[model samples]
Target chain A: MKLFSVEKPGLYTTYQDLGRVGYLKYGVPASGALDRFALQVGNILVGNERGAAGLEVTMQGPELLAEETFVMAVTGGDLSPMINGRRIPLWKSVLIKKGQVLEFGQPRQGVRAYLTVSGGFHAKKYMGSRSVYEPAGLGRKLEKGDELVGEPRQQKAGTGLFFTEIPDYDRDVDVRVVKGPHHEQISDKVVSDFFAMTHDVSPQSNRMGYRLQSDLATNHEANVISDGVPLGGIQLPGNGQPIILLADRQTTGGYTRIGTVIGPDLPLVAQLPPGGKIRFKEVSVEEAQEAAKQEEQKLRIWERFTR
Target chain B: MKITFYPLGEAAVKCCFHEDISTALTYNIQAFCKKLVHQKHVGISEWVPAYDSVAVYYDPWKLSYEEITNVLVPIANEMDAHEKKTKTVITIPTVYGSDYGPDLENLAAANKLSTKKVINLHTKRHYLINMIGFLPGFPYLSGLDERIAMPRLESPRQSVPAGSVGIAESQTGIYPLDSPGGWNIIGRTPLKLFDAEKEEPFLFEQGDYLQFTAISEDEYKQIQREIEKGTYKLERREESE
Candidate 1:
């Protein structure tokens, strides 16, 4: 049976798994969920694997019409999802029958949301991932009248699961970052200025990168021979603008990267809306790894709760 | 050669070989990359190799930054000891002049040479793939003939078509996908640089050598037809050292 049909594609809705892994050498970006924690928890609530393919709804969530009896869950942003015009709860799995329309209004919190079914999205896996990396022609964003198929599910337990602590998307966030591979290449004065700078997310920011508004200049010519870019790489182009490379960023670039946003704090950056204010906090790599460990511990706790 | 390890992020470590770009440094990177892949570690996830450095991404939950560096240091030390493998040489079929070659005249004029001379110069050298980047399957090739070198356009094209063979300064490459680029387009290739359906999506790898074979417009059409029919086999040969 058809899982759902897109009534409205919303701002942007695409299928994302953990990301396309092991393909960076070939220039494939690790295009995956922006808010991976939210996606994982959504999958956990729906009794799916952590890396299952799910819909990554942007500022506005897609309006979907279910065509079969299935269990589904919505996580990440509070997009004000409603089933047949009645408001539905976030972070909980719910049952829907045929003809029930799942409509998502304006987001109440965060920028992106995840929608997961008991079984993952039935999509083609390119290079071992279902992520929609448009440049590589792997998959595409959801459009009106587009039909999506899901794997046949037996419907296990774990419905109505709600996390005690939900992320506050509206608050200003401190994006923790580590000294980069090319950090030393930058001037000490510029590094200090970078730390002191208060930046706002550009309206042009997308899956590829978050262009931060900062007129900060580096000491040297911001050109490298071209090197592999890590996710969350804050690359300072010759234009003196900082572009935080994200999920759909090109695998490599010629611009000199000042630093990399810590993996644990990437979600904080991802949750911010356009014009969202963020401050870069330079921390030791050890501290960043410690934060990551704590975050992983939190996820593990959630994993236990969901099961 | 000193190998310095730096924290790329919370979960990955980057090892830099040297600042300069050369065949020797690239070979060292390739050799180190070979070792990392062959002797895979439990926590190691992926290795992203570029012109002068390789970033090793790992599972933070499984391994710490210190552990990752510890794992890489020895392998990096032994990289020079590893015997170099024969390189793979792939031939790219390109149709030069007219629409197939958008900036052929511009490139030739910039170098004060005839269009045919530019094409001949471009096809003469065996260009090395320093890295695959900027776009998927986009090869950053070196060894462009000095006479035909051209600077990037002052204003980049909003969108360059896929399979466009372009030259910028001392470098030449093909656009694997339609993307905004600043390179001077000299010709077009019929081969798909990247195919999502293929088991191995990319047409070339880092350290692989590329040779562009000039073809006619009719040949380009025929090759395109064969490619679409899934019958065209890319011409490749093992480079004997």
Candidate 2:
């Protein structure tokens, strides 16, 4: 059934899920929600499956008019979401009536947010996924006058998350990293300098990867044989700048990567807007794995309790 | 066939041969990938086979990094002993020169060869597929004839049409999708390199061999129509190696 009509297609809004997998070997990127935790929480709040398709709103949120009454939850970077000119709470499921308009104001916290309805958005699936990867034309961003289709439910039992469960996007984040495959190839001085300096998220950052700038400079010939690149792998090009490969990063690259940001800290890094401050701390492989396990445990616990 | 294991991240590990790029190394990597698929290790999600390495992605919740590396070491030891299997070489019908390949004349001049000679050199060899990357179904084929090999454009074109064949350095490939590319285009193919609607979306796979046969523009249009009507039969033959 028709759920919402797009009055305004906010800055680069697109439907996304967990991501497209098993096609990286064929050069297909695993384009998915950058902040996976937010998308998962949004889906769960609206009583939808964890991996259900949802609207991934960017810095500005779209003005969507509700065609039918349904339940929705907005999670991730707070863009000051509102309904019918009245402010709505973030990280909580809310009921919307027919003809009610939902929009967003200034980005008070993170730059991205996920809006998931009870039945999830019914975007056309390409290659076993609904995630919109604009480059290869697999899918596209939402445009004005587009009608969003979904499975509307009558139940309006809304849910709200605890204060401790929410993440603070306004502050500078320290992300944990594990040594990458080519870590040994980098000089000890360069590696130490990387950890010592504070990096700023470059304006050229996008879903493909985030280009970070720091004061440290080295004429390091960091080029290596082209090889498979992992998500969150920190690629150090010849200019000695770091590029954090994200959800839409290519499957393989030629540059040498020093370290990879742990999975648990990926969402935090994803939320950082342009000019946001970040620091990286090295951790053992075991420690990184343990952090991932703890994060997974939180998700499992939430899944058991909610719906 | 010694391989070293390192953590790509918490969930993925890089199994590197630490060897230079060679056909033998490519085969060993392909063979190891095949063995990996057969094992069906728990928590392993997907793997990407590149020049001299295979990156194995797994679920940290299901298995730890250390546990996965232990499973991979045994597979590496047995990979070299596997016999080489017969392969299939897929032939691509291409239309050379004119608007289909805008850079053909320029490349021919740079190499001090006639446009016809360049075409002949490009089609003479059956190139081995090193990897499929950069763009979906974009095969990084090796064995480009040195006579026709050229560097990429200084500034990449904003949009190179899909199936546009190009050469860069010692490598040659066909763009599976319309994307910004710097390679020197010399021909075009009507066959879709990538079709998301199909059961197997990608036309080429890693380890498969590719052969290019020059075709007339009219034949290109005919093949395009057949492909659109779902009547085109992909030409395939047993590897002559």
Please provide, for model 1 over A1-307, each residue's C-alpha lDDT reduced to its tens digit, 9 standing for 90 to 100: 5899988999889999999779999888999998888888888888777899999988878889998888898888888889999988888888887899998888788888889988889888888999998766788888899999987476754365444667667647888889787767888888888898888888888999889888886567788767778988899876767988889998888888889998877888888888888899999988988888887787777677665
For each prediction in turn, the share of the native Cα contacts (below 8 Å between chains A and B) that it retains comes to 0.85, 0.83
Worst 10 residues of 2 chain B by lDDT: B79-88
Candidate 1 residue pairs that clash: none
C-alpha positional error of residue A250 in candidate 2 after TM-score superposition, expressed in Å = 1.0
Best by lDDT: 2
- Interface RMSD, all candidates in order, equals 1.1, 0.8
Evaluate model 1: give its lDDT.
0.85
- What shift in Å separates residue A24 of candidate 2 from its native position after superposition? 0.4
lDDT of 1 by residue, B13-116 (tens): 77888658887777788888888888888989898898888988998888888888888888778766436667788999999879877899988887899999
C-alpha RMSD values across all candidates: 1.9, 1.2
